[model samples]
Target chain A: MTERTMTKADLVTSILLIVFSAAVFLISASMPTMAEQNRNPLAAPGIVPGFIGVVLFLLGLAMLIRSVRRGAPAFFAQDRGKPSEVDRSSWGRIALTVGLCLLYALLLGRVWFPLLTFLFVFVFVTAFEYDRKAPAAGQWKVPLFAAILAACTAASVYLVFQYLFLVNLP
Target chain B: MFEGLQLFGQAIVSTFTLRALFDALWSTQLGIIIGMLPGLTATMGVALLTTLTFHMAPNNAILILICMYIGAIYGGSRSAILLNIPGTPANAATTVDGYPLALQGKAGKAIGIATTGSFLGSIIGMLAMVVFTPLIGSVALSFQSFEFVWFSIFGIIICGNLTAPKDPLKGWIAGFLGLFVAMIGMEGIHAYVRFSFGSTNLSGGISLIPAMVGAFGFAEIISVMRVERYEVVKTKIDRVFPKLSEVFRYWKTIIRSGIIGTFIGAIPGVGEDIAAWVSYDVAKRGAKPEEREKFGKGSIEGLLASETGNNACVPGAIIPVLTLAIPGSAPAAVLLGAMLIHGVRPGPLIMIEFPTFIYEVVAMVLLATFMMFILGLSMVRPLVKVLQVPRQKLMPVIFILCVVGSFALQARLFDVGVMMVFGILGYTLREMDYPMAPLVLGIILGDILDKNLRRALILSDGNLAPFFTRPICLALFLLTMFIVLSRAKWFRALLAKIFRKNATA
Candidate 1:
């Protein structure tokens, strides 16, 4: 019977936001004077910063009040219902992707882009399907699909950018 | 009438060459495949493909990019209908009705309906572009520094409001933040350093590609890794074509969506996703009570409305790009690059510069749509079967491409660093509730918003009056207000009450 909403997170976020907005408003207000001293109109404008800060502060305060009045749904504390029904993507999948991407970035100059991207795409996609209780044939579907996608993408890049455009592929 | 005939004739002559047709077919087909993949996008396809076209004859190159541009947008609907996940941002609206229909074992009907909608939508957009490009171009001719700022702001705001869910305010806030981010490094007006913090690289602000990659691609992938694999429910799809009766039943939805899609696409920076959603909403609201209940559960009209709207947007989006040299979407921006690379400088006087270029473009779009219809119908089952290919081998290949795409941008190791940093940042942000589209729009529109606003002030000797005073500006301001207000619960309720009262009275 748990229901999750963004209100509680909004509550904590709003308080910190109000404080931050006030600080920004103050700093922005001061910067114009500093800019005037330094002869720069770009430093700060009274209407712009004032409008932004006050609005942010008010919005945050309202949200903060709303959060405190209505406690966070118990679902906020746990995964709640079967997550397959939700739009949420999982962390491990995200991590593997980030790692592969980071590895590609790190290897950008030492190796060509096509090589690195292909590896990352293949490994990560395969990893996503690794643990599935599959109908035998489909168990390795993830890796295979990932590989084909990687290969086709790389070959297309080569045919177009390198072969056609004369752009060097890293 | 004679002039129109001649223009069409020129378009045919320019585009009918064997080489041109071949290139168009290949690029369009390639764009279709790229768009069908869930992670790959039309914008990315255009960008990568443009890189390939750089060395070709400008005419052929522009044709390739245009074909890709048209094909990719149309292709996205395939994934939306079959997999229940949009293959491109523009296809997000398609999933709302499309996936539901697939689950109900009506995949073929939905796909066929979507394809027809897309084809008609494209034709409408192209015709609009043909008719209105001159009229709009004339208005743009008078635009200077004074108007560009308002135009840029309008673009960002409209994009923000339309893209975000229940929070156009949040989206605009994010957009303005992006504008602020653009203000970093050297000031556009005088190169007076603002937020560079004295870093020499910061002096030029940030490169556009890195920021885009960081915000969109990198961030998206990161979130993917964080979430373990998702178990998406997908049912088997049969032949994905619609019957004549089914398509005819949704004729009203198709027409309205076409008009709406074209109009939105005409606006700079907005694209297919917005068109689809807006049209879907229109279809839902316009439906009778019985029909309304079927809106999200795969009603043929819902599928038709969104697919038509988004696909039509491609032509609409391209109109402004060709006429004004300002892009209407991310892929259009890439297409602009292709145009510039191909020596086809699109601007207010593009017609004068290259008399038949506009017609050629229209013809290319028409050809691309045909290719999309053919490819999408034939490839659905084969595409699904592609997954039948092993993890270990695939990873290495995908890893290679990622590296190559990044490196090819500038041939600089620094760009690679920029890509990685942004990728990580993108991944992190995805985990949070921050939407990636606004950030991409931000990076894409950042400099335009900053430069134009500053230029407007400098041109006016530092007066902000023109922003609120101009006809277009006034309209945009009101829209922005309405958008923010509508996002509020009270405003929504108030609107509902007003509508209810109006209906009864």
Candidate 2:
């Protein structure tokens, strides 16, 4: 998103914050009071949350007013200085990296950790490397580095976290 | 005094063992490496290492964590100097003077000064810790529930104010939002679930570690990915040690920054970043006209002050952890959790329960400082090479580590999910210019705030007068109000007028 003053993003964020605070207030106000448990009624479970909700709502309202005060046209006007252009290649790489992470997490408990970690790192490194155009030697050099790093990372994680520290990593 | 001296002697003897020395060295080295890595923080280093030291003896484990904490805070200066990207938030101030030094081909000299400043700052902080922990612990004995409530509120307010000086409203929103998040779990007094939305996971409250990992680690990954890379300045290394004469020249800056950092660190929820900024500002104001002009352009005094401030904050942050069970910073928050897991409860009763623990921690911090000093000087060339590593390759690896670190804490996939959610949320919040420190502090202090307020009301039989009238509570409440008021436009204008009058006189 473009970083224009009082841009659409800020307006939306302020509105959402207001909505969230209202929800919190409503939910907290509905919380069951512990009269039967011999607790002080003043110490009801919702007191702090209720106060915080009001504070948040007021803050959000203030932000909304401030955003409105800054020319409303600024919200729609896109400045060239902070462009909101789509970079498909960057987005694709991010998506692939996130996808690989999800797959790694999903297969963790089912697969041996070292092998899974090694393969995931290898795949992720290679994928991102290929996404970027590089020198001719970059192909073999990137792959070699990825393989070595993957092996070292997998082994070290196994040895340090699992064996030495007794952290039961999946 | 005699008892303290005796305990200090015994702690020195105990912590000087081969195992403790080895732990200090290796942990400091690991901490430096982690701190040197962009997107990694001192809090993460402490949290990640907390798991590794689970099986160790209490003192030994705590030592390693302390070393990691100290080293990580010190380590961030390396990247700040070489790459102009602070490895951690605390090093942001360092980047001003440090990176300029790099541009001038004095990276080695800057690193040396930073290393020395860090060592001296840590030593000063350790001394302060030794002196203040017991004093604060004693003073905290009179801190009843009402006092604690105000203290918690004061912590959140002051933290928000310091972190987001430009727009404290966003900081307060983040903090209150964190408080609401903290309220999702079962109530402490009644055991009644507040806002779980019928989910058992929410009823247990959001786990702290995973949420923190997501906020700092995963969120940083996303932010780093979106930003295009910058070319790192290549600088030659001439000297890695400052001359004694040069050290003497900036001695005033170093000592002043160290003391300022230590005091700021002792304040609950405040941390190294604020301390560094405050110290840097003070140093700039105190410099001569020509020297002041050099403040952002690689002034050695500026670099010294910034590094000293942040490094001193490490031990200063720990003082409250040992004294009142209140962490002074995020890393100290993690350290507090580690201490709890290791069955070392730190509070007003710490002295009665474990008399020697404070002294032991002082020794550990001292050891860590020496080790950081040694490793920082020896590994400059190798450590600076980290700046050359491509962010694409490094960030993904860090992402994997973040996953492991989050899950490792509780061995729960649910926590991993929490990390991911907070990561996205944190990134969005960052884009909106909200400060994250106060939010983290609110999460850390929310339970204390809730329980203490309720307990105070219970003791007063539902009367709120004592919350306002009690001496300590009254003082804390007034301080909090002052902080909130000082930010008002009128109040700022009045202060500016007073300063103007004073200058005219």
Candidate 3:
């Protein structure tokens, strides 16, 4: 990242960390000490986390001070232009990858293991390799290759995990 | 010593069987392929394989993982030499001299020297591991809760300091964040859950394998997808073996680099990357004027030092894991986790409980090193083909493995979700320039820190005197303080001023 971008990111991160640490500290302080159960107060479940929360807060404060001193707030005033086509394409690809992964994860147990895996791999490869600039007639090869790879991968993974490793697939 | 040697002999003899050899061959080959692939790291490879080896005998499983570890660390140099891209972060230093050699049409020679250096380095590291693990284990047996509490903190501090040299504050934050993640599960002593938010899955806590696969595997998949593709540098191979005299000419550099690498690897949370860089820098400093001039311009000594240092670190990194249940590197942390899953606890008591196990580990490293050397030299062309596999085609398969690897441990879908969350968190942290080593170390050390700190407190009846007074505890505490303070600009300026005054005097 550029210096300006890093400054802004650090500023936002420090604030979030500060908030998170404070929440941790408050919640930890409210946890039961188990005194009535004859537990040593020093051994309370919240003790270590409470200490961590305090340290994290101090670290966050340091980051906050450093970013502010670096003029993080001033960077916010700079207007940014629209992303280039390459950047937009990269973002689209990332979004598509995440969406497919989420869909696969969500449908994992509900669907047949091999089938779901095969579909996920096939769709992912096809989506990435499908060149919109290319002629539509040329796209069949990419999907065909994807299909073979997906099928092989799905079969091997299922057999290995289930039969070889003795892991019961969901 | 004799008994140890005897056990080491026995371990070597037992591992010489056909089945073990087969396991060693295939696992090492897989490790090399994984390492040769950009965005696939030794840590990720070990973590993913841990799930696969779950059903095997403990010794066999550990043997396979060790092979993978050694092979992967060595395999990274292939890409570094051939494509100028360090397949793993550990091989980043190798690219300096390696790619230059490749560009000069000596890629085959570079790979040859690298493989030899890796073999020698592993041997040196293995020797060090044999000598040091028992020594460290014996010393660690005397440690109490007070010492352990400080030790864990020291590990986190030093790890953060080294991993994020540009900005250690972010490193510390990542480490502490990992510690907090570990807090979600039930307290080890009282079984009281904190930060679970009333979820049963949360109370069981984040499993290490899932979190690791997500952070290293899934996050890598995403990161790899974001980058543009790289082209392979095609160089003809006239020679694949370095002359013995050529290798032995830099014997001093090899030994020096090996020692430096092993020492750096023994440092908690530090890994092969730093080891390689430090060895490279040291070798350059120690080289003659003419040789030094060729440091990054395809110097044989530089490549040898870097390759050896990193390979040595693989064994060096395992030392602390065997002795203190603390990982010397990220990959070692996963190995530690695997050991735990296999019901072989590695800590201060390892020497007493499984005295021969250390020897067994040594044998495994030895076997893996031989396999790495053999496969590295013999299969250069075939391994080069692995680098040509398109990321778009390969990444989806990797993602599928990540999903399966995460879920295979417990067959719980919740773990898969944990993997996703950690993957995003890991990617974001990477983008922000935060180091993941300290974060992973923090997760591994969390339980030890939490349980020990509380136990120390209770023993002292809330008095903090023993924490300050005990020799080891005091040493660790002071070291941690020194590291933290040394990072401060004011402290550095003050030290610089003092040095200037002293020089004048």
Candidate 4:
């Protein structure tokens, strides 16, 4: 990221952290001190987290000051209407990967382990390898190869984890 | 000394069995392959394998993990030389000189030197581990709750300071965040759930393995897939061995880098990447004028310094793990977790409970060093093929492992979700230039801090004097303060002004 972008990010992140830390501190303060149990107040569970919350708040404040000193507020205003350098394709790919992973995670216990793994791998590989410029007939090889790899991966992983390692896969 | 030698001998003899040899061979080979592949880091490999090897004997499992650790660090130099990409972060320094040499049609020579340097570096670090661990372990036995609180805080502070040199505030924030993450479940001393928020999984706390596999393994997958592909530079390799005289020419460099590497590795939470960079900087400064000019342009000394330093750091990183239960590096942290899983508690009491275990680790390093040297040089051609496998096909398979590895620990789907959460968080943090090392170290050290601080407070009736007055605690406290103060601009300017006045006087 460019210096301007990083400074802007720092500005935004610091605010979020400050709010988060404040929440943590307040929540920790509300936790029980266990005075009825005759526990040492010094050994109260909330002390460390509260300390951490205060430290985080200070760190966030420091970051906020640093970013402001670097002109993050001005950068935010001056950078408006500029074209973003963000890579949309990369973001798209990441979204696809996350979606597939989430689906796999959600379906893991509900489906057969091997079959689920096979489908996940197949769809992941085929989707990534798909060429939009190519004809549909030419893309058959991509899915075929993905299927083969998916089967091998699913079988080997299943055999290794479930049989050899004796892990009861869900 | 004689007893140590005798135990070392026993360790060597016991570990030399055929089954052990077979395990070492395959695991080291797998480690090398993992290291040669971009995005499959040593930490990830060790974390994933910890789950796979869970059913194995403790000795064998640890042996495999150690072999994997050493082999992977060495293997990263291959991609550094051939593809201009460090297969691991530790090899990032290797690419400066390694790729230049490859461009000069000397890739084979670079690989050979890296392999030999890695071997020698590992040997140096192994020797240091053998000598220092027991001594450190004995000293650590004297530590009380006051000292431990300082130690945990020291680990997080130093790790954050060193790992995020450009902006340490982010590193500290990440570290504190990790410590907070460790606070999510039931408090260790009181059994009070502080931040569970009605979730049973949160009450149980985040499992380190799944969290780690997510942070390093799955995070890496996302980062790797987001980038464009790299083209391998095919070069003809004529020689795979360097002349003895040529290696001897830089004997001083080798020893200096080895020591520097081990020292940096011994520092809690710092790892091989920093070690390599520091060693390279020192080597460049110490080199002759003409040789120094060649530092970034196919200089063998530069390559050797980085490769040796990073490889040496593998053993160096293990020193704190064995002695203090604090990880010296990211991979070492996972290894520490694996040790706990295998019912082998590592800390100061290790000397009393398992005196021979350290020597056995030394022997394991010996075996792994030899295997890495042999496999690194002889199998370069075959291993290059492993790097050629497209990331598109490989990542999905690795993701499968991540899911299963997370689930295999306790057969809980909750861990998988934990992995996903950490993965996304880790990736986002990485994008923001926040170092992950301190964050991870904070998680490992969080329990140590939380439990010990409260214990010390109770012991002292909350006086808070022993925390600053005890000898070790005082030293740690001073050092931590110095580190924090030195980072301030005003403090640095004041130091500079004072030095200028002295010089003028």
lDDT tens digits, residues B1-505, model 1?
A: 4786688777877677888768877888787766766656777677655544556677777778778877878778877876676878889989988888888887777777888888888888877877887678778777675566556666666776766665554456455545545555665444455455677766666655555544555554444344333234456777677678878887788889999999988776677788888888898999888988988787888888898899888888888888877677767766775686567888777877886788888878777777777766676666654432332343344334444545565565665666677667665444435455555556545565556655566566677788778877777777767766777789999999999999999
**Which one wins by TM-score: 1 or 2?**
2
lDDT of candidate 2 over B382-457, digit per residue (tens): 7777677887778767777888887777787778788888887897798788887788878877888888887887
lDDT of 3 at A116: 97
Per-residue C-alpha lDDT of model 4 across residues B393-485, encoded as one tens digit per residue: 999999999999999989999999999999999999999999999988988898998999889998999898999999999999999998998
lDDT of 3 at A134: 88
lDDT (CA) per prediction = 0.67, 0.84, 0.92, 0.92
User: Which candidate number maximizes DockQ?
Assistant: 4
Two-way DockQ contest, 1 vs 3, winner: 3
Worst 10 residues of 3 chain B by lDDT: B379-388
Q: Give me the displacement of residue B83 in model 1, in angstroms.
A: 2.8
Off by over 4 Å in 2: A1-7, A72-74, A77-97, A110-112, A131-138, B490-505
CAPRI category for model 2: medium
User: Using DockQ as the measure, what is the rank order of every candidate, best first?
Assistant: 4, 3, 2, 1
Candidate 4 per-residue C-alpha lDDT over A67-154 given as tens digits, one digit per residue, 9 for 90 to 100: 9999999998998999898889998988888889889999998999999999999999999999988889877899999999999999
Per-residue error for B309 in candidate 2, Å, reads: 1.2
Fnat measured on candidate 4: 0.80
The alpha-carbon deviation from the true structure for residue B400 of candidate 2, after best TM-score superposition, in angstroms, is 2.2
Task: Quickly count the clashes in candidate 1.
Answer: 56
TM-score for candidate 2? 0.93
True interface contacts reproduced by each model, as a fraction? 0.36, 0.48, 0.75, 0.80
Model 1 TM-score (2 dp): 0.79
What is every candidate's C-alpha DockQ against the true complex, given to 2 decimals?
0.27, 0.51, 0.81, 0.84
Worst 10 residues of 4 chain B by lDDT: B379-388
